[model samples]
Target: MILLLLTVVPVAAFTPWARNDSAAYVFRDHVTGVLEKRRRKLDALRRKGGDAIIRDAVGRGLHWNALGVAFPRDARDDAFEKFAQTVVAHQPVDRAMLRHDTLAGRRLTAADHDAMRSERRRLATVDADQIGATGDDARNSRRRLAAHDAGRLDATGAAIIDDWGLSFENVTRISLKAHAALGREARKQNLTAGVVEATLLPGDVAAWLASPRLRAALDAYLGAKAYVRTRIGALRLTNRLTAPYSGAEPNLLGYPSGFWHHDRCGRRVKAFLFLHDVKADGRPTLIAEASHRTHYYEYKDLLQSRFSDEYISSNYDVVQLVGPRGGGFLFDTNTIHKGRSDGKRGRTVIIADFMDTRKLYTFKKLRYRGPCGQHRTVKMGGEDIACQSWCRR
Candidate 1:
């Protein structure tokens, strides 16, 4: 018994699980502090203006981050123009609808109340239904349908994504009760502590899985009604208290939290729902618009180099996604993006990934009924989401 104990102890210590846990424990605090310090340094650099870090980074011609070297102005305008043209004939939104303030000590007019309610309803509707040009009222609905069937991002959806790798629109309004409950439950699971994968509680999962707005967004992006194959891949909650650092990461060792990277393997679509308001100082995510279409791995060697400013500024239109509660963005994970953290107030968001069941990461042969009432089969090594079917995967 004494000999067996001695042998097992040394062998087990070197097992993958034991080694990984030991590394995490030993490095979590040290790496986190190192990353936080880097973030503070970069934040200082950003404050120095155009001629400072940005100019220096762009001056170095080795890195490209934005849409293409020459982002055709007309192409960018055309994407947004289609959506605006569709809404051109509608009655103008009341001026009151544009006021982004809370109802505090202000006097309330009936028009003000009506406008507020109208805006709320408008925010809740999906694009197809919101626009008369594509909805039942449109004479062009049939034409739109045919165009959508061509297997690409729908006209309006394409416009947004073509201009940027992601798009933002308010799709759902969770009740205060539900939103609070979600936070409470997430806190109970201590999801904020580390980058561990987790699933939402059963109650939260059902609400998200059955979200009509999410379904609509998927259909719009797919240009066809898609069947959600998985039980909704893990609903991750990230509290960006310790945002990933942006620095010279030679490898994972000096890599800051959430370093600039894209999800590999396929074109994965994810919905990020912010449970509360995310202001500029609140550690909003920074995404390089339309970076998904470029070859991301080309900059691997430069990733660890000292051109941190270039990685952020060169051709990349970095968008700091700041918005009100219930507002969020749907994006292709293949895009270059990262969460920002100042260690100030953290934000809570639920992210759900959607993809065709056939491309889901699983080894076993599996069959299941999708949310869209279609049966899907997962064979090993199936076709993945290509650019043509940006929304389907």
Candidate 2:
């Protein structure tokens, strides 16, 4: 069972401007473009080995250190050279083609085409580096790509290019490593074999939090600060409780915030609590089985069959916790879980999201790259999707 702590922070509680406005649109557009480019390249390679041609041509003339030589003192140029090398190692032929010239006329064998496609698929699905690339790099990349595409190559453009160069380098490294991590986790979990959906409820949380008598545990755990109430559409806790120290926010998925996909790296709500009792007949939450992996589209049919809506609707899963006032349930976030609304008493529970901050920082240090874009800041149904995205399986 996956535990997700829903922090029902009223929209009005936080500063109005604290919400990110530019992120969703920009990210949507950028990611779309990146995917498109990858698709086109793969298509070209499949059709005429044109991708190979381009890579060969680019590899031949690009000069291993040309970017560095062109901008000798530019740290960005140096970073780009390093990045290019790394990219080459994974897709040596592509890197070679990108630098080579005479390879333009070279013909690829069927095996070669298959290999290229495999590499393309690998790159397309790779997760962003959790640590590589800084926020600045992402910003710079966006700035440069915008300027270059707009035909503006002034000093500002140069700076943007530098930033973009660094960003590309960072994202490439981070994404590659993250992909590797995902593969390892998948194998460890035997996910390749498949998993079945598990039913979890707020009563579970309450049972865990309750004592031998199964009464409210608020007085024991939360003391006097704990107060239960129904507001908006769900039950919630209003007081603050002490939490273990997690490191500076996680930057999983190469985004500034650590909330783009589960398994990327960061502290996430591992368990959820249901405040009300199950016999109360509350709304049911929906959890998608086998939805934890990146292949979200694969689960579309399953979601449509199960829910009134399709497309997984939003990245965030609404969960209902039903239990006694002080009882709660706990579970991991790695599982696909959601709360459903049967229009009954919205289950109420004290929610707690936890992450191993130390592990998060360690992952960051292992994969840290320069920044390239702003952290994700999109909201859906008054909840932060960025964090949910990170928790996405």
Candidate 3:
């Protein structure tokens, strides 16, 4: 059987926050004209401490635990072969659309597949250290990160890459375009920006995954040629109606993403591009530095569960993901982190996910995928759906 780590549970089994999402969402923006009461409720959560906020989340449901060990090979050999064979037979890696193209729509050549095959073995050898964790002692991930950022060139120079080809002006232009596209998508869905994050299709995004700087960074991080997830997106976090809109659901308890959690996906790295200046004041992402190697608590229903802030903060040194408008960074999501959603000045960013080539056949299948604004019939829960993906349910 396929090791369906993130898919075995029913949707209703998800936390109450995930269940209460309405398709037509009224967002809490800085705008004074709309949704006053709703905005105040979200503001209150923003003012609260992490520990208190997390308690509200678990207050409504059971905290599930994992049945298996940490980071086990999610794809058994037989299942991987079967799925790979079916994919090769039906879709086939090619020079055109679907699985053959990059998230930004770059067509893959025979050379690309050949290169990937050569490095396929790297996928199986991944450990916490390969993706982002450093050093032997799990307790020292933060100290190690601090030392490197403070001037350990040997460590910082290896995995962190910043030589992306796009200039700040070019990126700013792209960010503007991305927000406009997301706005159109949100209006179509009757949802606003902060809560709904939509994937960028071929035309909307540029083909930068293959850029040498980024490609080399991912190769160093994954120890293999990286495979892109089909659902890469431009993320926006603004309280103003003008900041790009994407809704995940507001947990009456708390924003699920703001709580501490490690992504259960195996070995993968994500590239985050800042579209505007974000300092400590901007609602920047907070990560327990190098916490990927540490396993504080395991959950049975790991898919929809989160770790307590009290436990994570007590153990790890947390830091903000801050940078200029065109700056970017590569990170392993398995590290303990929270994507901050509360801020005064809105934030705009582009996020891309990549994994080792060998991991491509592993993740549980996405039963539905459609263009951002188009009407696509999803065979989920025996009903038609607007959108669905590995992240967007």
Model 1 Cα shift for residue 298 (angstroms): 8.0
TM-scores, all candidates, are: 0.43, 0.27, 0.51
The parts of candidate 1 lying over 4 Å away from their true place are: 1-197, 201-205, 223-240, 243-257, 295-309, 361-393
Off by over 4 Å in 3: 1-163, 240-254, 295-304, 365-392
Which pairs in model 1 have colliding backbones?
66-315, 66-316, 244-257, 245-257
lDDT, candidate 3, 216-271, per-residue tens: 34543443334544346777666743222234633423345666665544234677
The 10 consecutive residues of candidate 3 with the worst lDDT sum are: 64-73
* Prediction 2 TM-score vs. true: 0.27
Local lDDT at 383 for model 2: 34
* Best of the candidates, TM-score: 3
lDDT of 3 at 82: 32
Q: Write the per-residue lDDT of candidate 2 for residues 1-393, one digit (tens) a residue.
A: 123334553222111111231122223332344334434544544465343433442344432210011112122233434434432223422233223211122234566447434433332232124335454553343333433422321111101111112234433443343345445555676652211112222232332322211111111111111212111112321112111113453212221111222222111222233333443345433343323211111111111112112323343343333444333343333333444323434333333233332333332343421111112222111233232112122
List, residue by residue over 110-227, the lDDT tens digit for candidate 1: 6644743443334344334534334333324333432342223221111121111112332233334345555565677765443333344324444544443444445444322232
